[model samples]
Target: MATDSIGNVELTDSTPTDATAFLIEPPRKRTKTTSGRRSRTNFEMLAWLFMRLSGIVLVFLVLGHLIIQLVLDGGVSKISFAFVAGRWASPFWQAWDLLMLWLAMLHGANGMRTVINDYAERPGTRFWLKVLLVAATVFTVLLGTLVIFTFDPNIS
Candidate 1:
């Protein structure tokens, strides 16, 4: 028992269970206010759609490519620098390779971006991870395009 400066009576430690109940309890959940503007747009919807579309196209492109490369004729042993040169001389193979490269790269980059967004919790961490991902994707795309377009057979 205690008394304030005004001499009002007060109780101390009278309800020990109440005090202990709070000590062992979990915190209350936070409620976000939805009365404001809309939340940020979910880019995941586009990414999910892209994955499905790209996967279907890639299946066709990759299967056709493999059949032509492996099942048509002499297969791996028949492939050489001359074979590559002959193939690249045609616009058909060049276009096929270009499409495969672009689609696969875009699909893989978008997948990795989703992964980064899911795992990287911190703002700085997510930003830097996406930055690195973009850098790698750009470098690979550019280098692959250059190689596909400028492959020289006459080089010694």
Candidate 2:
């Protein structure tokens, strides 16, 4: 039992059933590392790094997009099909839009993966959710890329 700012509360200890849930000890006490699990943590580290870097880039890319589309020129009223066609005609704008699309989609997928990992309790549910997330992400990215690249200015 414990009493704090909230009120009386039961303090119970929790032990994880997963085999990988173990306290870190001194290097001398450490056991042999599993070969099968190599680089799993590395992937997580890369994902974390990607999130931070992508977020920074997204801020600039998104702000620039907004500034160009809504703040500069004739403002939102200037946005039209012809304007978009003219914009996409440039390779520079195509590359910028493509990079933004890929980054935003991947960033959102990674965030959702983190959420599914933290909140979902069942392993099966989590696996399926992640599978669905990947499928949706891939589908969206492919479709968006295709649309961006294949857009025809002459379509009436």
Report, for every candidate in turn, its global Cα lDDT versus the true structure. Answer: 0.86, 0.90
Model 2: what TM-score? Answer: 0.73
Q: What local lDDT score does residue 20 receive in model 2, on the 0 to 100 scale?
A: 67
Total backbone collisions for each predicted model:
0, 0
Q: Encode model 1's per-residue lDDT on 1-156: one tens digit a residue.
A: 567899876666344555555555565444354445656877768779989999999999999988888878878778889988899989899999999999999999998998988888677999999999999999999998998899998979
lDDT of 2 by residue, 5-122 (tens): 8774545523344756665863443335644446545888899999999999999998999999998998999999999999999999999999999999999999999999999977
What's the CA RMSD for each of the models? 5.2, 12.7
TM, every model: 0.72, 0.73
Off by over 4 Å in 2: 1-41
